[model samples]
Target chain A: MIPNTKTDPVIDVRDLKKVYHIGEIEVPALRGVNIQVQRGEVVAIMGPSGSGKSTLMNMIGCLDSPSDGVYILDGLQVSDLRDDELAEVRNKKIGFVFQKYNLLPRVSALENVELPMHYSDENSHMQQRATDALKAVGLEDRMRHKPNELSGGQQQRVAIARAIVNEPAIILADEPTGNLDSQAGKEIIDLLLGLNRERGTTLIIVTHDPDVSAAAQRVIHLRDGLIVGEGESR
Target chain B: MKLLQVLREAIRSINSNRTRSFLTILGIIIGVAAVIALMAAGQGAQASITGQIQSIGTNLIYVMPGNQLTTATNRRPLTLADSRALANKLRAPHIRNVAPVITDNNDVSYGKESLQTTVYGVEPGFEIVQNLSLSDGAFFTRAEIDSRASVVVLGPALADHIIGKHEGIIGMVVRINDYPFRVIGVTTSKGGSQFNNPDTFAYIPLTSMQARVKQDLSSGRVNYILLQAEDEESVKLAIDEAALVLRENHRLNLRQPDDFSITNQEDFLSIASSITGVLTIFLAGIAGISLLVGGIGIMNIMLVSVTERTSEIGLRKALGARKLDIMLQFLSESAMLSLIGGILGILIGWGLASLIGFVAAQSGTDLIPVVGWDAILLATLFSTAVGLFFGWYPASRAANLQPVEALRYE
Candidate 1:
């Protein structure tokens, strides 16, 4: 469906549903979920274990498709898009920061950051863009260092650098500081907050930590497969 | 993804695990090397035989005494009269000189030095019909043949063996089976000569050999005939006329198979080449098994690699790599492994073939193995195909991985 004359929200969902089939068993991971967010809003998704928060994030990130209903990402109906097209959407619009950092262990930090940029349309200025992104995350000196060579915080910073290098519309962090100490976690949260405020990048974080949720301007709580509560965080 | 980028990634992955990559491609290297070496040997043998056939003479046909499969009752010994009849213009118009040869093994002695060698009693025209040329002095004349003179022409090797010197060999007298014969000339050596070893025979007049060397056979009989046609173009005509004359002389009817066999270099060439061709293909087939095994090894290792790097694959997909991208990455890795192996195999095969050829030459075998560019190209293409064929399943498996599931994998 086309967005009308009204400015469309960056992410729009309606009646989203997901079902997992493990052999003969049917596990309904999500059912009848609806959500929409503006272009520059920072939203945190919070829920206990088995609450479908991960599945919802997976749908929102375009990593997995909704089993039924519609997901409109940047005004395009992503639920109807094929796998390759969805991959393109993910590459162009979303940047993910995983809990484990997930930097390729053998590659240098700069090369790790250049991974997302390789998929980006602007191929000519990849080196410069990756350098700028890494510099922004204070990893310029660690550019040539590999993941195993770097500390946990520096590896996460490289991950962040990789996420923002392509200048995606939305940044999705799933437990971005889950493996870090409090100081490193605080640093990562502050860097993400800085990106949100300065660049007006839409941010959605899935986390169990209240400290992570408190930083978000708005928080959406999920239970089973539905969003049961919403509030502004202090 | 860019092709260059994909290739670089493949190279990097291969480089990261050098030992495993080397071990994986060892089968390919050995397979390709074996194919190249064996094919080269087959081609070398074919070429060597063809050269020997050419050295026999231009436009020459050999008339052997008996059929290859004929029994003694049907077998008839070729006679000098038959050779003489073929030389007659009325009987065989295209025929040139005919040399009827009668051969015997004899001990040749020069003073105290003695050697066992074949002695051929051939007519004066043997030099022309058998492609022998005088390196010193002269061949025995027809007058010598008529008189059954004791003049003998030594083969180059025989001259060297008897006199132990090349310069004083022309006038030296050597005893052939205790009969003294003056060395009138020495024939030039033709290496790897098949039908008659030109370098090892002592040639005397045919009448002398019939009377003294082989007293058992009748005066008119000889072992085989060498018939030289006017030119290469007239060879078929010459052979047909010779056959007709011989068949009439033998009193063979139309239904009867001829007692004698007449063959040319072309007949020998085709038969020899076909055998070598078949041998080459068989050897290459055996070598190809190793490449197939090598390919399977690559596929196995690739599968392990995909499983080990599941999270990396998931991360790449999440970062926006398509299925084709992932598939290409793995496919190229396997291809790169095999391509490198193929190249290395070519070098190894060439070196080993040359070494074998050199060793054969040292032992006077005269084999020269050739590793042609065609073999190299075929091996390259075959190895790449092997990589693609065996690499397909693992590549597809990696490509079809669901990002969420792969990401969650430990």
Candidate 2:
């Protein structure tokens, strides 16, 4: 595990809450949760069904706004930002990876990696940067291959290339290897851990797999919309 | 996002569903083509009719007896005296010449070929005033009118039909109303359809017509008078001068309306154009309704597209695309579809209009469909506007989707 060398935390949350209203019922997905993680940390959030791990990941990724709380990502207050501002934050700061490898179906791997930059302020050298990102993910030979033409492991690697293309501060991965076979899943895990080690990219992965958690520098446990426990791994 | 990138993305999406996209734009294609084709037809009809009228003569005016605007039955008949008065240069300097004409349909026969056709009783000035030129022989002289002699001129078509040829037909006696009148001349062909053909008439001396055929010499009345102005610029002035002279000859004061109406060539042209303008607008309006229906079809397909691509929208949002980006992407896709359909519609419409012109020409009608630039521009702009307008709702729906729900959607 990398030592906590940074003085300030990259992500700091206090009393985060999210409630969904379906007609007349108020269902609380996240209630009064708090979390803090340092830069260059690889953290895994683990929970069974209805444990609010998905909601927490959504909040951290800036894909949604919390009902009530304080969220400071990289020292910028994000809890009260509007929808468009959240989109900007997501574009420039947070990258996402999904278990299904949410790369656009018909687009080539290089173009998929270029998507975040298309939405970013970086207007120059996009092709070169996307090509470099694909190379980093060991997908240089399959730059022109579409998601369907790739294997599960290759698709996940392409998704990782897309995630890191903009050099975002955090890579928020949800069930990144849930759809892959064991061997492919191990390769994907190694690729991600290798990124964490080589580039020091902050990774916050939400998964139920113990093997993925064992590979993280720290594992966070959640139950019933609240954090139950956390411990340093290694 | 760059516009080119958005357009490229739109093209890819549309190309994926080629059949659906084509079907969706079919309505726009038909609507735009109909608008162009029908407008072209209307313009062609207007052009052909005006061409025919102008072919009759330049700077010509017609003086007919009656209050054409009112339902009065006891209208006075125009007299040869009115024609003579309008012909006086001192009284109406703008009037160049006057021809008094009286027409009656009569059975005309040369040899054994007999056909019922209009016989025009006219003075020598009729040849110049009506722009008639002889194909063979010569026109009757003023002495024929003074002596009330039996002399006749046949139009080219009339000569061809009754005597089978214009050559060697001069001096051939043709019976008009069973009265023999020697054919003096045959006028040049002025190509027209059978229904309104000017090249199918027989001309004779006015006095001969009144004395022999109608037996109305005592009435001293002519059907109408044809007046030619010195030039096109003086046509209106000639009409005004003729009206003043006719009022004086008829003894009509300021309190009474003139018994005769003088109509200039510009009046005919304006009336014909206005009628055609209204017809064109009416046709275009109906075609616009179909374009509106086409817009509705685009909206329907876009709505379905948004629904089908729900997960894509979610994925794009997660990748940090703003709502406006998503909206513009869908909007451009629809606009592109309509613009393409509009361009194709123009080509097809031109083809259809040309076909109409070809068919009309084959049947001896001088019609050439005119596809104006204004029609094409209007169709292009209107179709694109329709796409954007109708696309607004569905695009907004796609933009407003929440990433969480969309990503979860199956």
Candidate 3:
């Protein structure tokens, strides 16, 4: 993997803003928010409620477009791309983990992991890749179990297995430990750190827990849809 | 994504809600079944009427008084003289036999048994012209007809009603409208058909009926004339000649419509077919309305499914599924639902039509329920179209969902 520094961040954003229209009123969710994360870097985004962290996560994950921004994902200009083109970029470049471990409730865990590969053109070895990803998440034995059949932590593990199945450039997680107990939360954070160190994957995590943020190599704070502070973590 | 994968996903989703899916497609099942059953019944009726016409001999024609489309009231009725005139070889050489038919509804009795039956006063050649055969004694001869003899030919059913046995009934005497006549013949049984059950009637010579029974003999009027054409090819010639001879006999002018109508075997067949065709269209029209309602039901249920699975849609989108993929998934689900329902409906309709045919057969009517492959194919096409048409809106709704908005939905 190529080592990327601040000058060569995998994700680059500048003056990104998102305004939602509710009839005549415009609610600005993200106001000129900008961030950059290097390859193999574990960064955490922390913010109070309604601070537009979720909005920022959505923009970075390519799930929504900004009203105005210059966003580049791994050197490709993505902020102006169409919905289908953005989906392609997300499929190949970004993986997402939601707070609720949003795995499809009806399918088996292995199939859940294989979900991302279905959208990929290089899907010939999807089954083998999904099995390997599940094994990496320590869910090899629970491959056939559905999401509802697994524990909350196990389900989140399955979600992580899905996120990494395509070997995406960056993992964007939203409150990954919010629904877990202290023990499961610690295990999840350790897993995320291990992925960053061993695979050189870029991690941009949005979290509320200070302990989770303290484990990251860097922390960026947001308030009122703007970045307020940034510092290297111990 | 591959089409097979989308279909697989759709099948999995539909299988997850088996009961609701089945209930949702019930309207389609019933609608398709109605269409099949109505079309089958109409085809069966047409076949049955055609068979009846063929059984009556394809070469026969009926010259009845008055227009077939209008009232016969006040029109000059047909007469035995007109029938005899049409039988002349030089005038209507295509005619094989011309039998004058005088019909009266009467009560005929034996010792203590009596029956309300019809009495047919026809010439001696009626048995041949009507394609009837005797089971017991011979039909009246021309001499018997000239003598105005009180001899009668009994239909099998009428003889059974009067005498209780077919073996010794020919010589038995039965009363017709309180007048006594000796039964000389008993007709062979024509199976229990829906139209024209001649087995309930007794036939006598036209002279015997006119002289002994009718009070209007001076009018020289007979109800109608039954003409047996030489062959099916000669029917047109026979009809034209009979019309000409009758018009001359009745002294009608060229500008006026004839007082009588000539109906042939083919005419009856065509009329019967057209009526059933119209009926089939009408029944299918009604069934089409129900199918439209069924389509609406599918749309409503699919919309509900889209809303209920909003988060799932969002999740799929997040996983990089395109709008086309999402749309195809829902479309396949709806199409599969309607197609399964259509197959079940075809079976139900076949069974119902067979039941109708069974009942009709038991009553001695030839109704063969026809389920043509064309009907099945049309039904399949129609049901699939319904699925696609009804599937579009909800599928588009699911496909157009914004991942952010959908993920936030409760």
Sorted by DockQ (best first), the order is 2, 1, 3
DockQ preference between candidates 1 and 2, better one: 2
lDDT of 1 by residue, B1-410 (tens): 88888999899999999999999999889988887888788778878877777777659889988777655356667887788798899889998888888888888889998878889999878888887888888988879889999888887777777788755577778898788898888887765455455687898998888777778887689888988999999999999998999999888888778789899867877887888888788888988888888888989999999999999999999999999999999999999899998988888989889988999999999689989888989999999998988899999999999999899889
Error of 2 at B143 (Å): 2.8
Docking class of 3: medium
| Model 3 chain B worst lDDT run, 10 consecutive residues | B68-77
- Between candidates 2 and 3, the one scoring higher on DockQ is 2
Off by over 4 Å in 1: A1-6, B64-96, B102-121, B133-138, B150-204, B208-223, B230-261
Instruction: Write the number of the candidate with greater DockQ, choosing between 1 and 3.
Output: 1
Candidate No. with top TM-score: 2
Error of 2 at A46 (Å): 1.1
lDDT string, candidate 3, B325-397, tens digits: 8899899999988988888888898898899899988987778988888778878889878999999999999
* Local distance difference test, candidate 1: 0.88
Listed in order, the DockQ scores are 0.67, 0.71, 0.64
lDDT of all predictions: 0.88, 0.89, 0.88
* Runs with alpha carbons beyond 4 Å of true place in candidate 2: A1-6, B69-77, B109-115, B156-167, B217-220, B248-256, B285-290
Q: What proportion of the true contacts does each candidate reproduce? A: 0.74, 0.66, 0.62
**Cα error of candidate 1 at position B314, Å:** 0.6
**Best of the candidates, lDDT:** 2
DockQ score, prediction 3:
0.64
Residue A182 deviation, candidate 3, in Å? 3.5
